[model samples]
Target: MDRRALPDDDTVATALALALRAPSRGNSQPWRWQITPNSMHLYLDRSRSRPVIAGEERDVLLGCGAVLHHLSVAFAALGWATIVHRMPNPDDDDHLAAVTAVPRRPTNQDIAMSAAITRRRSDRRLYSDWTAPPGYLGLLTERAAALGAMIRLLRDRSGGSRAFEPRPTTQGWAADSAFGSPGPYDLENAAAYWTTSTHSEHAPAGSAAADEIAEPDHADLLLLATPNDDRLAHLRAGEAMSAVLLTATNIGLATCPLSAPLDSADQRLRLRHDALDDTAHPQVILRVGQAPDATDLPPLTPRRSLAEILSPVHA
Candidate 1:
């Protein structure tokens, strides 16, 4: 690789800026980057890791993987090829990946997916009732597989609706409900409650009702899983997640990556046995469909500045 082909510090900085846009749990943005002349290193910023929501740092690792994928895509768009080594430092668990960029002829897919990175957003707003076109989900599955992950599509008719039902509990709140018996609608209702409560101040008077929209009947639930439930698998799942999201956006679909349901150990077990039938370990669930026509999309989530996330590494 010609050293001249490697991106300058400024170009690398810009790429890191775009990569930081990758979605993270609760917008925690738990990652750090060290840039040398020839390569960039990805690290898990333990200080920013949300232990409460991201036990064992699974989601944190996934988020870092997303950023890694985004960086690769960004470099490819800029006529560079990226070689990534995952978990490159066995001695330092915080070191997630090392990526080196070399000059290459950019492909059309690279440019398109790079553009999609900015377009993709985790839109939690309710999707329109329109169903996805036939074979769209298949394309998403193919994309994920190419990146070493599997995607399972769960439709309403295929017992997918029951997959998210709150588990029976012997104790308070039935584990899902704020009160009363938990049912299929419990999770949906709880979601609505949280959305309403969180965004109430920004909502217009009498518009609280708008937030009560139930999960769309036409949208499909996508389960992103890996064969192994380890750190490397989680990282690959996250990369697959970034690919899936970018592909969905490139083709003009609405998507929201949901991590809450799989946060707890019990929920993960239920998801594996009940939803996926033990085929694979579920890492995250994505709600995907078409956005309502003439509706204003939510603003993009805020991201940490590049200066805040990147540091120079001395040789």
Candidate 2:
């Protein structure tokens, strides 16, 4: 492959095609792309976000974030290293990310993740009642941390609507890297810049609400929480979600995104007060466990054609 400062039209189109497989709420695939002279831009196509109660669904950020990571994985597999600029435009909320693809040899790890994208599926069927080994859970946390987010294992859900119980995860955010990274929503000065409008890291702990946890079941649930609950944070959580899901798929595991539970304002409030101790905002709860049989994974869900997601101005 010829080296180029930025990938050309065909190369970008190829990656975008693969990126379309990124998971979204109900496979809504609410995102758009624009390949400019020097970089590829990602946007939230709000028209397809599928708002529940009101406007501008928050899960759209996560969906876009998944596609963002998927794009990077595809580029890497195609022998290109992408330097991503997340939230490049603070003035425009729709502009979620801008990625520049630099041609380079792909690594083994890159190829693995890219391959996982195709094998991955949202398994809504019941996951096997197996405890995910600590080693695998560590890898899942690492994947989330790599993208400036974190994951915490929730007490296994048997199917109760009670507050999510903390399973005591070993993952923590690298505040330095997350805040140091470029673009808007910098967290270096988090004290001054961020507020606890959503969920908080400083809420009171040991409350009566936090102590009540239901019994365990056949589910392995992980909460994809972020330090801040802003749109940018939601997007980062989405990217982390994609990485965790892909990692799980690569290692022979099943995943189901449980965003519907938190859709209710009351449920989210209960989770914050009861489960997390209000220490972090829960973006999405993922059910990760072994499928009954690896050979019997769910079939691939339908996706929009490349033409639908790409900029209409271009071919």
TM-score attained by model 1: 0.82
Q: Could you tell me the lDDT of residue 273 within candidate 1?
A: 90
Candidate 2, residues 222-288, lDDT tens digits: the string is 7778878888888999889999999998888877776654656766776776767888778777777
Once superposed on the true structure, which residue ranges of model 1 sit more than 4 Å away at CA? Answer: 1-5, 53-55, 156-217
Candidate 1 per-residue C-alpha lDDT over 1-315 given as tens digits, one digit per residue, 9 for 90 to 100? 656535887778777787888888767788999877666889999888875353577778788888999998888888888899999999999899988888899999989999988887777555566656678888999999988888876443222554554232233223433433222121112222122222233333444333443343345678889898999998898899999999998888877776655656897898789777898898877767777652577677788888798766766
Indicate the worst ten consecutive residues by lDDT in candidate 2. 183-192
Number of the top-ranking candidate, with lDDT as the measure? 1
Which candidate wins on TM-score?
1
**Pairing residues by index, what is the TM-score of model 2?**
0.77
* Model 1 CA lDDT for position 272: 86
Candidate 2: clashing pairs of residues? none
> Candidate 1: lDDT of 129?
66
Q: List the residue pairs that clash in candidate 1.
A: none
